[model samples]
Target: MIDLKACPLWLYRLLPFLRWWPNVTAHTFKADSVAALTGALIVLPQAVAFATIAGLPPEYGLYAAMVPAVVAALWGSSWHLVSGPTTAISIVVFAAISPLAEPGSPQFVTLVLTLTFLAGAIQLAMGLARLGGLVNFISHTVIIGFTAGAAILIAASQIKNFFGLDMPRGAHFHEVLIHFGSHLTDIQPWVATVGAATLAAGILARRYLPKLPYMIVAMVVGSVTAAVLNARLGQEATGILTVGALAASFPPLSMPDFSLTAIKQTIFPATIIAVLALTEAVAIARSVATRSDQRIDSNQEFVGQGLSNLAGSFFSGYASSGSFNRSGVNYASGAKTPLAAAMSALFLLLIVLLVAPLAAYLPVPSMAAILFIVAWSLIDFHHIGEIVKRHKRERVVLALTFVGTLVDLEKGIFLGILVSLLFYLYRTSQPSIRELVPDPAELRNPRRKFVAKTPDTATCPQMPILRVEGSIFFGAVEHVQRHFRNVDEADPDKKNLLITARAIGFIDLAGAEMLAKESNRRRKLGGNLYLVGVQPDFCEMLRRSGQVDTVGEDQIFRHKGEALQAIYPRLDNEICRRCTARIFDECHVALPDGTPRAVADQREAEAALARLHAQGATAS
Candidate 1:
């Protein structure tokens, strides 16, 4: 075993699998092999179905499951993430290139290869640039919504095959529904029968024989039923169709059409595929990692996915990403390392070579039924319900993303992200600015506590204290300014403003300048601004912005006591003399100018007050 920490950068870059290579033990090998076999069986029908969705040959789907799967497993970061042809990527490929070239034609295949190459290149570039953190911008709500929409699309895409209806190819969601409605009379009974049987068998197996692979049971049931129906009713009477025999060979070398027209047509779609694929792969990996208690390096996963696609383009594969079904099954089957994913690809190749011709007996409707199951599982209903019931903003994001995905699969997530970000910015831009007053009872307590101002609490008429509860960045400067302005309009006599700055999380240059300007305005009004419990960073920002000098260095204090001690002597002496609201200890002793009326004078004054009260009592 090589010491990875001491290994050179170039060596690790060349062979990322080395990081996990040492984890392959005798026990793990046996565990991974079992997982691989299970995953291989699960992916077989899915590969063909996904290929059919992409308008590619059945063999191409099997090819995608082979080399790309192995490459991704070896190079990717996740222990159980199995990369291959997926429903969303396949649909996107069909939608993008179908208009430019006929589906399943040489021209279409070449264009797809080119598109895959370009997308892989883009993904690789992004990963190498360490931009994997970009996926963080895609919110959990957006993912849930997109997944739900994609699930619907998946079921919708299989409707024609499941029912044996002759709908036009590459139709939109609404179009598919409309066409299906109009062609209700054209539904073939045998096909629907097979699909229904497969769907039922899958559900039963999953419920009762949880240890067995439900998809295989469903496929076998659907196939046997189709054969029995054909035998009984005659082939002409039963319109059951089969996914034709797949070619049993290693992925053959392929070439892309690098023509300018082809590049022009596929480049933009390629960009979309790259982003979508990376997002899907990383999301699946992270989801499974949570269950496995594993840490996934997203950047490395990106690199792995990119390289797999790149290798795939030259080896007869189309756009592929992390397959949730396979990954989940892999983990559930006790996969211990990435080797399981790699072995799954190897097992799939062997399975294809051995049973390529046997696929002719597999009914297309059964495949669709399996896909139906896959689609249903993709939706996270528990989380969706939680979002809808608990979070209004998240619910909006979820709805938009879900609807957008149904309408436009690739762009829907972007719309959700946009809305989520806008909501975030709006919230952050409006921080809480509240008026606070020292609790009179807690004033004598060692740790001074402040509470929201109420009419019952005695407060100094000259100085009003306010608490800032969020960052004072440029976006929030206007809001803070408006608050200050409101305070001024509400009480002109409260010119000496003391801000409790402990809650101000951050203060940018604009906030510093604003504070300075407010301080100057208050000074002109015969008072000034003071800040208590000012954060060090905020003070540094004020200093750097050259506003500290404008707002007097003495005005900033570490504690409220120091600020009050400094500002108490600066208040108007006339106001103090007439004011009865002696809220502070300093207020009772002397006026602002240190004019200490003697203790003897206070006693004499109290005696005169007592004499007046006695005279009033006698008169009464």
Candidate 2:
């Protein structure tokens, strides 16, 4: 075994696969081989289906799943994440490039290759710049909603092929539904029968054979059913169509359109694709990592996905992203390392080369039926139900994202992210500010704990203890200022303010400046602001901002007890003599001016009160 710890940094940086290449052994190789074969079989149908969705020839999907998968497996951080053609990327490709040129034409394919290259370049740059944390801003609710919408779109797009309807190409989601409804009488019964058979076979295979690849099984059944029907009913009677045989050669070297016009048209779409691809890749990587008990590096994943797409564009493939189905299956099939993903691509290439001619037997309706199953599986019903049944705000995000996705695919995710952010900012802008007072009940207890101020609790009229429960930033400065103003407005005598800073999670320059201004204002009122249990970082911020001088360094204490001890002497003796709420230990001992109080009289008063309490209890 190679000692990775002793390996030089440059080697690891140049060839990241070196990190895990040392772990490959005979035992792991056998495990990975089993997983690779299973993944290869699974991707065969999905690749073709995704290609159909993207308006590309079916062979291009196989090409994408080969080179790109290998590149990403070797370069990425996750052990089980498999990169290939996915439904979202397929729809995005079709949506982005369909307007530029005729679908499946030479010009359309060139534009797609260019777009793939550009998106890969952008992803690579972002990874190099360490911007992988940007995906965190996109909430899980947004993903759930967007996925549900995309699933519906996927099903809608296949309706024409599934039922042999005369729906126009590249129709909108609602338009597809409308066309399907209008053409209900025109549906070919033979095509529908094939699709129904395929769907039923897929559902049954998945239910009975949990470890088998249901998609390939479904396709076989669908093809056999379609072939039998076409043979029995005759070609003229049955209007069933078959997907033509795919090319058998390896992926050829390709070039993207570099014309200025093509570049201009595709630039914006490329950016959208880059963001969407990275999000999908990282999310899938992390999801697989959770089950495998591995830590994923998001930045590394970004770089890996970028490199994979770049490789794909040069090798006769369209844009690709991480595939959740393959990755999940890779993990569930007992893959022990990233080698399984890399090897799956090789196996897929060999399998496709051998079976390319056999694709002629695969019915278009059968592929459509299999895709319907894939689409339904993508919709996470359990999570969606939980979001709707439990959280109100998250449900709003989920609904908006789902509806927006049905309207527009890319913008739906953006809208969901925007709503989630707005909700986050609104909540952060209003921090919880509470007034606390020392509990008279725990007066003699060793541990001092403060409780929320209530009518029954007697608090010092001159000094109010306040606790802030969130960060104080520019967005929250106004709220914090208003809170401070309300305190003085309600009780002018409460000039001395004791702020418990332990609860303040963060404080910015605006917060420190506000503290300085408040300190100056209190000084003018013949009082000062005291901070108790202040965090060291906040103290440093205050000192660096020059607010420590305004709110005297002596006023800042490490413990609430210390601050209370120092501020006790500053209260007025006349008020202490007349006060009945002996909230502090010092209040019971002497007057504020160090004058000895009648300790014997205080003890006698306490004894009398105890006797009254006992008599009241006896009466009850």
Choose the strongest candidate by TM-score: 2
TM-score of each candidate structure, all chains considered together: 0.87, 0.92
Q: How close is candidate 1 to the true structure, as a TM-score?
A: 0.87
Q: Cα RMSD (Å) per model?
A: 3.8, 4.8
Give the residue spans of candidate 1 off by over 4 A.
Answer: 1-3, 291-293, 439-441, 451-460, 500-507, 532-540, 551-553, 557-620
Over the stretch 270-317, how does candidate 2's per-residue lDDT look in tens digits? 887888889998999998888888998888888898899899999988
lDDT for model 1 comes to 0.88
The per-candidate count of clashes, in order, stands at 0, 0
Cα deviation of 209, candidate 1, in Å: 2.7
Model 1 Cα displacement at 405 (Å)? Answer: 2.5
